[model samples]
Target: MAATAPKSLGAGEGAGNIGFDRSGIAGESKGLLKVLDTARKVAKSDSSVLITGESGTGKELIARAIHRNSTRRNGPMVIINCGAIPSELLESELFGHEKGAFTGAHRSRTGRFEIADNGSLFLDEIGDMSSDLQVKLLRAIQERKFERVGGTQTIAVDIRVISATNKDLAAAIKEGEFREDLYYRLNVIPIHILPLRERRDDIFPLTDYFQNNLLDRSTDYQIKQFSDQAKQVLTHYEWPGNIRELENMVERISVLVEEVDIQVHDLPECMITPSSHHTSSSVSSVFNNGIGFNEAVDQYQRSLISHALNESGWVKARAAEMLKMNRTTLVEKLKKMHIKPEMETPIF
Candidate 1:
């Protein structure tokens, strides 16, 4: 047996160019497209962007996309996870410290903000930052100046800030856990990515991509395909962990499923018979609770519209025709249903 060569992306498929095909973004879902569009547009400026989404939705990847497309693309893009570091040490991590500032501060070291000067600073898990630190961060961001953890001399930085979080900052603010003032400061341009369950169209492409990329990286692993029934299980399953979970699932199957093909039985129990917390169970509950006719009609309409849009590849005009409704009527339905991207997609 021999390893297969990696399949290169077609022309203009890479990120920050024609589309967001780069960085494992792999998908054609409406939500994915809207996310890329927003990120690329904001990348041109030095605005502070706050990205919101469920964990494992690729927030860091989106941040990198923005930094790569920005004017400071050539400069370094420093990233720091606020939640990962302890409160006692996070200050030094962000602002650096001078010698003898703290017990472990043996010598002066540059912090993420200073390192990202004239570049981009990505603050992941901003929601988890301590309130006291948030105040300091706010001051530094507002003044573009900061005194390192131990140093008294102020250092000025010319950098763009991109922050992301899975926690609900609004709710945190109300709960007195997160600062509202800092929230406004960081949220100049807000971008949100829907969960994987809502964008079922992406699951297949992502599966294909993970398998192909994995094969390229691991010669011992042979190329693999998902059976139709397995694919159905994948798309129907509610991906509570979102994109990261899907990627992991593909990697797991590729590594452990000895066969070249993956069948329904190979899928995890979560995908086959989803649990009560899963959306599949929720759908069942919708019927079991004895819903009214009007509520049933609304639910069916939402599902119908979603199916049409997804079937037409989110070409609103085409989806409208498929549903035998005018474009404007479809638009209203989409709005009421909270559908993504108001405008109709242009033909490819």
Candidate 2:
């Protein structure tokens, strides 16, 4: 028989919930909205969920949301970064170890499954796991039972599994890198997170949300407006790094551009340049003879400013010092280059 569903499922309460707000998942994209709705419905059931997305697309967050909205919200939610742990150590980490199980096993350990009993176990970057581990994981999921290293007693687990991966598991299976049976077991309920680029509508609201949230923390700047030109530039730039990149950019601009209202000229050079899609030919020609000296310098300056902003975590004064430029001079350059510190809400 299937495991019993936890009471209060879909009510969004408990430690396993991780405070994942439904609003965070809401987006302008119809596809995303549909996905969120489906996720919500699935959360009501006790089914394993497999989230697939690009590296920075917030798969973990979605998993948390699912767990929070699920019946097991009150239980512990354990997260295991499969890629971060070495293959040699992964088995012990997931299955725990008994005293004297192997070298340095002085005491018994409770694995992630045991810790997350009756809750959720998020296996992040599952694509990076080895085939041996995959077989172990598959057996554990099928029987909900595992044995600790060097221990004969069978330990039963009552936890839901949520696995995430950026890599194409089908391709990995074809390449003999991943187990096909494990893939089928994990793919019972699949949810694909749309990248920020695909859901442009969320950009502006997310920017505003981050800005307002930052300001609440007593940031230096009191200004909270973006110029029309600045908005255009932001919308045009192809955000390869997705929402995380956009968030970083907004925080940088918020602290750097001091004006009550940000304008187009306050944008970074990369935003204004026609070459959002920089070709190798363009890069080579632009720097080969050091020709277009002005443009190259502008690019360098923009990069310097961007890097400073990122390094300083979007604090303008710190970024200014890092850039080795006077605060006033930095502000002037920003204006001249049409680099706006404030980004408009992205419309999907």
lDDT leader: 1
The per-model lDDT (C-alpha) reads 0.78, 0.73
Error of 1 at 146 (Å): 0.6
Candidate 2's C-alpha lDDT?
0.73
* TM-score per model over all chains: 0.77, 0.72
Off by over 4 Å in 2: 1-23, 214-216, 219-223, 268-348
The digit string of per-residue lDDT tens for model 1 on 1-348 reads: 555665554534744447433455577777788888888778877899999999998889889878877789889999999999998889989999999998867889889999999999999999999998999999999989999987899999999999999999999999999989999999999999888867777788877777776543555777777765466457556778998888888877776789987876677656654345644454653444345567655655665676578678898899999999999999998888665532211110
- The best candidate by TM-score is 1
lDDT of 1 at 157: 96
Model 1 compared with the native: what TM-score?
0.77
